[model samples]
Target: MNFSEVIKQSNQVCKVSPDGKYLATCVQYRLVVRDFNTLQIVHLYTCLDQVMHMEWSSDSLFILCAMYKRGLVQVWSLEQPDWHCKIDEGSIGLVSSRWSPDGRHILNTTEFHLRVTVWSLCTKSVSYIKYPKACQKGMDFTADGHYMALAERRECKDYISVFVCDDWHLLRHFESETQDLAGLEWSPNGCVLAVWDSCLEYKMLLYSLDGRLLSSYSAYEWSLGIKSVAWTPSSQFLAIGSYDEKVRILNHITWKKLTVFEHPAIISNSKAVLFKEMEKRAVVGSEDLSVHQLTVGNSLFSTQSKYEITQLPAKVSVVKPDPDHANPKIGISAMAFSADNRYLATKDDNMPQSVWVWDMQRLGLLAVLEQTAPIRCFVWDPRRPRLALCTGNSKVYLWSPAGCVSVNVPVEGSFQVQSLFWHCSGGSLILLSKEQLCLCYMDTEEKDQSTSSDCNFTI
Candidate 1:
């Protein structure tokens, strides 16, 4: 319950520095840098117009930003804050911004256009490639950095365009017939790409990096659209979450549906799949307010196993599992979790809200935290079980088994925080709001100083 440092910005988009020393963000028409140790804003460089998106170069040397109103992209050196370069796209606005894995160049999209322009900072040159009439919403680079997976959003149908990164050449395109594309991600080894649709049931199409439709899987019994999809670190299994509040484990290579575990309620989104070390199994969360742990042998999907599916009810919201902890119930949401995983922190969409932690492990109830306004979002710090709750009242609360406690922090007024993410690497806790990203970290005096870290798994 002790977050003593603050990094504030005007814009909503912010990216942590690769090495975790500093944070680069966009503010009121400017780029700002803040020191993690001192919790002080050190440098600020104003720009001509509002920056749309920002990305840190792979080498951590430069931060490339796309200025929307200016219709230009610029790269700034972190070492020499004054040194910056700008490239023009000869358009009205900027759409997307990304850096190659090598950090040698960048890719930018023009407003409402199907063309993506590649900019080389070193050579000061730009290359353009056009695609079908669809705006690319999300994009990812391959592990080798040779190919790109672009998520193009059309009217009712969605498509993915595979292009060669080196020469900006179009390789192949895949179109969906049943559902709209919900999410796109490649496997950790860059071998397979998991594509989900937006129907009531979870449907996925796995394709190779070379644009080959390897295999497809569908759940006709479950009527939930694929909310979220996660691939294990080892790339051996793929976890799919559906509206039926069930998570199915599949074999990545064979595309076989192994087992499906049902949650208590309708899962509004796809559940994130992660490897839990304590149980040495897979942890899956659902919108019905439950998390399940299932053990699958290396060849279990190919054959059969005795480990029947077991699910424990969890808090339902736009919640994310605690990446640092492997415990089944230790998670972060816009709510809370009890000591024995029986009580969960939760709130509704109305005002005069009450925070309740329902105990699912013991199949019972725990405690309730009283609040004035509606509690919008929350998370229980895995390192600290006391729940951190943010409400529509514009306040953040830290509650424990003892009683109600408050953490010393500023009330973010720029925009309401929509989500909370505690970096497993241990630098700072990120608050994703509507307008700006508020980064909360520990002050230098508090004692435990853990470095923030991130895993590089695809999908």
Candidate 2:
């Protein structure tokens, strides 16, 4: 695949619309929206200050840009290009902002978490929720966009707040077991909510939408507590990654431990684990470790007793050297499922030069990719099976079953590639380095067919 460089400079990270038709990025003090296929500017808005952050509405009809110097936010709609809405926090300043799942409301937090403001586009009004103290973790909106959950500190205690999105009314507020809450997340199906204590405590609490605590879990005292939590797409199982180098899957129905996946590198910490639910199977990827494919029979209607978990054999193995100063610690740094759910990518923390791609259907290694420099991160196209990987030397490698292509991004000073975002159609990619943002378009059909088969690998 050949990639043509589009935008060479940008202020902040770029975001793609949900449908992959448009790309939004901040060019200094202006927000520029461009056509994903043509790389032509379609809409541009100049803000009062440099744009610090940008988020697209779920429906891809609106773009929200946050100003850096001033604590202000600007919302732009595609239908009305001349008219725009502004959100400002007078003295406190805006700390962060989020768009509701339904793309109807905008949520903003004041500087120091002094308060939270909910802005509705349809009503053209705003509501406020005062905070007694600053919260480390912010609020979360359910997948269905009907409810919002957040943790607040009140009078030396931490309480979880659930709000109804329709009227922005406080649905319920309940005190958790520990006042030191760390995170809050609602299941994808919007049936349950999970809250966990900070690393100081190993308690994980599950609650219903009505604020009733359904179950609580604790890690062994010797463990370092839960590092991260992820719910299966079906909301039937919750995977918790602990510092003890083990991932525990819990059945929501039974509220009991279903199974545990032990990683090979005990010293390598797990930042996150991912689960991809396919037709009749599920793929689990553990950080710095391995990937397991399980045959989840009757996952939709059955309980934990009826599920089957199987660990796939090692398709690709890394050579581990003795732990010494010369050989840095090794672990799985990153992993992602392809858009089609047929390929899986895994990267090692120490060996950034290599990446492993697995075929989920056949449960085997598909390809092993090696690069000139250590890989910083990689993202799969949301609409295609193509993969884009960024390395430490400011280069990106695009891979597919057809072939592989590498692009070297020009750099002026000392900056590294930070992240990458793909347009919904998988034709455009936005690369954010430390200093600038760039846009690149991929032509999958125009690549040299003679060389396409040269990089092909089969297992």
Candidate 3:
């Protein structure tokens, strides 16, 4: 299938609307809403200033934009323009921003500095936090909004600092003298925090969100830098992706390494791995196109069952004697597990540009999707199990277990596909091919068609 005529340009930071009917993208001064089924730009917005990022309100009637520049944060009521508000500004060095789970507050840094500020959307008030070092990234509000985790960088060392946001109280800090920090994340329940290092040694620390030191573990010693990290929705385990072509699932509380999944170098490019949900299981995608799943714990460290690394095809260049699996061979370039945790999909570096989907519960093969040239990047629908694969030929294929649909989208005159994102609400699908961002939806006939949508695609 070819997607050349089906794509549309979305100049905004696009998001799926809450109900799965519309796609929203933020352009220079506006947040544009499009019909998901039509892949058509339906509504246009004019949001002033450069919009850094935009997130939807729980109800879908409002959109929040974290724009760069001094002064008030912007809140837009889609139905009522007058209800929008611009929040007060704070210190410099604020490089990132995030919303609290309750959608009541916004957490952002002061430029590139170490201090974090919490802004109360309701009160329009701001609170500042101080960290020991300048931060690289990883300041996130837990799903409950009670806690925030910070990964700060100081020279070569990185510190994982946890804080109670309600009172701006310091909870604990995970530090290492030998390794520099790379990233940090909190489990869904806000019970456990995983901290990874940038050093060659496989170094990661798990901390209890309540300020307790839970445990720590390292991957095989290739010094392949840890690239990405994620926690299962159930909170029982953590998934760490590394440059070593392996993704390891660890018991959150016990620090026991449970599973190691190997991907081929071509698919993974030996970059990173991430976990997505499908039905009741967890789907993990690697820099290689290899994806797999296992049971998830409702609580941290719920799985202690031993597992050997399941080696993928020979195309996946992984070291032999991988402690976890024997013969793993799915080289993954980009991947995402469906939100329901049922389907695990991967984009491979191979020809025929394909996206593969596997049954999470069965942990076996399900379908192989092909449309254009080698799949460069793709994302799964966060609200549904659909897969959107972008290819090197500058094409996009919307794939499901049933079949594949193509959308050849280009933003302005851009060529190769760089990234693709599925809106969490299922209202829109975003394409980042080359430098420009394009938003798309199904044709007009599909606009009102409702399916079990629960996937998110992102570059």
lDDT of 2 by residue, 263-364 (tens): 442222222211111122233333311111233563322111111111233122335546566524454445566756576676655444566565655544
Shift in Å, residue 268, candidate 2: 16
In angstroms, give how far residue 318 of model 3 lies from its true place.
12
Looking at model 2, the pairs that clash are 20-424, 288-331, 288-332
lDDT of each: 0.56, 0.67, 0.55
Q: Runs in model 3 with CA error above 4 Å?
A: 1-12, 19-22, 33-48, 69-72, 87-94, 132-136, 152-159, 165-178, 251-255, 264-335, 342-374, 383-385, 392-394, 398-418, 423-459
In candidate 2, residue 399 scores what lDDT? 74
TM-score to true structure, per model: 0.62, 0.72, 0.65
Q: Is candidate 1 or candidate 2 better by lDDT?
A: 2
Sort every candidate by lDDT, greatest first: 2, 1, 3
RMSD of each: 15.1, 13.1, 13.4
Instruction: Say which prediction, candidate 2 or candidate 3, comes out ahead on lDDT.
Output: 2
